[model samples]
Target: MSKIWGRILWPLAGFGSFVLVWYLVAVSGVMPPGQLPRPDEVVGTLATQFRDDDLLLDVRLSVLRVLIGVAVGCSLALPVGFLLAWYTPLRQMFDPLFSFFRALPPIALIPLVIIYLGIGEQARLFILIYAAFFASVVVIYEGIASTDEIYVRAARSMGASEMELFRRVIVPLAVPQVLVAVRVAVGVCWATLVAAELIAAQRGLGASIQDAANFFQIEMVYGGVVLIGLSALVMDRLLAVVMKRAVRWQDRVGG
Candidate 1:
């Protein structure tokens, strides 16, 4: 459809340009094929990878891990962020701890997590969850906290109860920001999932890329890297559509 292509044209053009530049550079002998695979060779490798029975399985498993972690992180973040923002005492008690944990990288905890949780799917899921939770909780909390006090005051002046003010005034305003946080959380989860898979997983894309490196399959490695970027782009576009739908007024204003 024209509308769909309109939305994607710029990104597609950019990607095409990137490939053109990469190919030109490689073909120019600036980087040998042994160092940087040609774009067409990478595409060929990707086509071959797609034909493999395990590629889809690996993608599915990685997506499953990301989804599980997103679910866990969001489930905890929403209620906790809301509670912390709503109650001063609770906010004081937890905010510093949240800040502390947020400062620590998920990769920093990978070794300890692997030691305690084992090199299983649980450890991978946990790492993703941890990263997503840290990144999301602060965003959501700030989103809630940043709700206009004027709106709350106006609602209260209209005899709205605290719950009503929060439900009707604060939450609706915060939802857009919260969704952005979720989008960011998704990206963090993907990165952490890849890091987790780099160590223990046998069939994940990251592991496949690592294997390709070991075997000197530069094309496969390039293809795997391209797949990861493409997957992220697809997800980001999907989320952008959802965000536009949810915040149509914002889009109208921006446009």
Candidate 2:
């Protein structure tokens, strides 16, 4: 029982302390009245918005966007990264280009995406895919490339075919890293989501925030931002559960 409470409070301790301080500061009036609202004010705003502002619909749409983005990004990136790592010649030819593309911010591609895909679901999904693809590719390629040479040699000495070697050996060894990549991809997708929705989305957390800020509705802005953050937190925890399940075969998870 004590252990259970400890586990529950362990993560909340930092956030709870921070909120306490914020509440005190907000009430103490170091900043101007409109600068930062009280914590309760923000809570009230959240409650009111959820009750009448179609916040649930916005959340559903945003979640759907993330799901689609993650699926597309993982599907394309996993194969490319695995193949590149296995085939050094291809990696050599593409690494420089890959680096260049990855270094570019996903938002930087928004203009081109708008021109090509227009300001619609495609544009938003493009941003998410662009952000997650490079992230996953880098992680997966590194994971596969760093595979132990001894294992490779042993597998090859047994006359293991390339497909067998990859499918049976490399893939299992790389599952943990791939799962980590999935986590990173999810975060990247969420981070880029707001920027994607800000462009032409009629309804989304990002759109709500943009609208709130335009009218100087600080409470509304904070509420939307908090919703985005909390949503990410929940999804990340869900991913953590998935990671635990996927890596159950390993005695200990390695980087």
TM-score of each: 0.91, 0.94
lDDT tens digits, residues 169-233, model 2?
99998888888888898888888888989669999888898999999999889888788888888
**lDDT tens per residue, model 1, 77-134:** 9888888888879999989999999999888888899889998878888888888888
Candidate 2 segments whose C-alpha is farther than 4 A from its true place: 1-6
Instruction: State the lDDT at 159 in candidate 1.
Output: 100
Residue 132 in candidate 1, Cα distance off native in Å: 0.8
lDDT of each: 0.81, 0.87
| lDDT score for candidate 2 against the true structure | 0.87
